[model samples]
Target: MSDVAVCSVVSHKFVPAQGMPVPGQVPASARAPRNDALRCTACSMRAICMPQGLTSDELKRMESLICPSRTIKQGETIYRANDSFQNIYAVRAGSFKTVVMHRDGGEQVTGFHLAGDSLGFDGVSSGHHSCDAVALEDSKVCIIPFHLLEAMCREVKAVQQHLHRMMGGEIVRESSQMMLLGTMSAEQRVATFLLNLSDRLRMRGYSPTEFHLRMTREEIGSYLGIKLETVSRMLSRFQRDGLVDIRGKDIRILDHEGLVRV
Candidate 1:
């Protein structure tokens, strides 16, 4: 299909829900009939994911320029390390984990992205993606052609500032992750991870204390610089201490104060 004809975003608004790992079951929302939407303005994630203070003219330009939303099922990759960087994406539904391969031939997860996140900036400097963006659930991402976005930013001060803020946020997040691996104990890492997830969920209008973990323990361990066993052990310990309840991937933070103390 022509890019212009498919430019309207497909309505794939994120709604937090999960269940047992069953292969045949994809999200009902993923299977829903595609409805052409008004690009950025119609997106439910706009408040958290898009630039602020866009004038009506700029917004219309954005809606006109955006490419079609792309669907990626669980375990599918939206982009991989070394692919030519042409566009960035905004999370419209579900979540993703970005990973890079180590020289030892293992995947080292760099980040877990959720609804309202913007991705693909890692390639801006090099013209190729440095990591693979693998969907953790059936997902959709609104593709923004980078060349067009750059042109818009050059003309719109608000848009430029928003891009700067996005870049700054990513820098802070990576710095925090480095500190997490170097300074924090296993227990503290686990607690801090849960707290951070809870905080992000709260920001996205989900319950702060309860949510399903989309990434598996092995993936979490990769991100935290811990082992799969250590990840399981930490969670078990937290459950025993009444800090959290974990049933497979489901996690409920029971004691926010106690967890912070850990």
Candidate 2:
């Protein structure tokens, strides 16, 4: 594969994560019903996130408070390393990945954010971003002017709690990544990544065990701290062992327990 093919490119055909309605198309009956469109947007993460505590009026106010920017093309940088932080960005659509470069010229993927995921939290403290955020596909983001969101959070208890919880979650995720890289064998790392992806997809309201890979095997290997050929070999082995099914970019976990035992 070409080096360019290994890099993630955000495409217009990208689907939004769960909790977002189909973009730009609304049923005629939806217009007359008492059903609020934002509720449809709030289908997931209702109990644990900032959107949950906001009243309809507050949400409307939030919509107006934040400025909507044009969709970012795949591979476009949202912000580069050392860029000044001006706004707290919320992913309104599509996905993003953060990359940090090492002094040795190696690249480490810090995290991947899907729709409704919050970015810019780290920048709040650093003032300048430590990593580069690039769109995985054509994506929309809402720029919540930092000053406005800061003031609102001071007044809203739920928003404060939500931010705290999100930060805590970040710590946990990083810790999990460390464990995966430090402890797991190549086969185990691949298995764990498969499980992790399945969990994340399920959280996004997709099939947990069966889905397409958004990131390339090279990217996967990079993130997991392994060689690309090792990733490919292990995957081939998994397929041969009847633990997984791989076709094109699509993957299906045929034996969950067997995968765990890898």
> Each model's TM-score?
0.85, 0.79
CA shift at 203, candidate 2, in angstroms? 1.4
lDDT of each: 0.76, 0.68
List runs of model 2 lying over 4 Å from the truth: 1-5, 8-49
Which residue pairs come into collision in candidate 1?
none
Task: Report, for all candidates in order, the number of backbone clashes.
Answer: 0, 4
Question: Residue-wise lDDT of candidate 2 within 164-234, one digit each (tens)?
Answer: 77777777877888887888899998898888777766766769888877677877788788998998999
The TM-score between candidate 2 and the true structure equals 0.79
* Candidate No. with top lDDT: 1
TM-score: model 1 vs. ground truth: 0.85
lDDT of 1 by residue, 86-174 (tens): 77788888988888887877788888899888889999999899988878878888766677678778998988888898889888998
- Give candidate 1 regions above 4 Å deviation: 1-35
Q: Name the 10 consecutive residues with the lowest summed lDDT in model 1.
A: 1-10
Candidate 1 local Cα displacement, residue 222, angstroms:
0.5
Candidate 1, residue 66: CA error in Å?
1.6
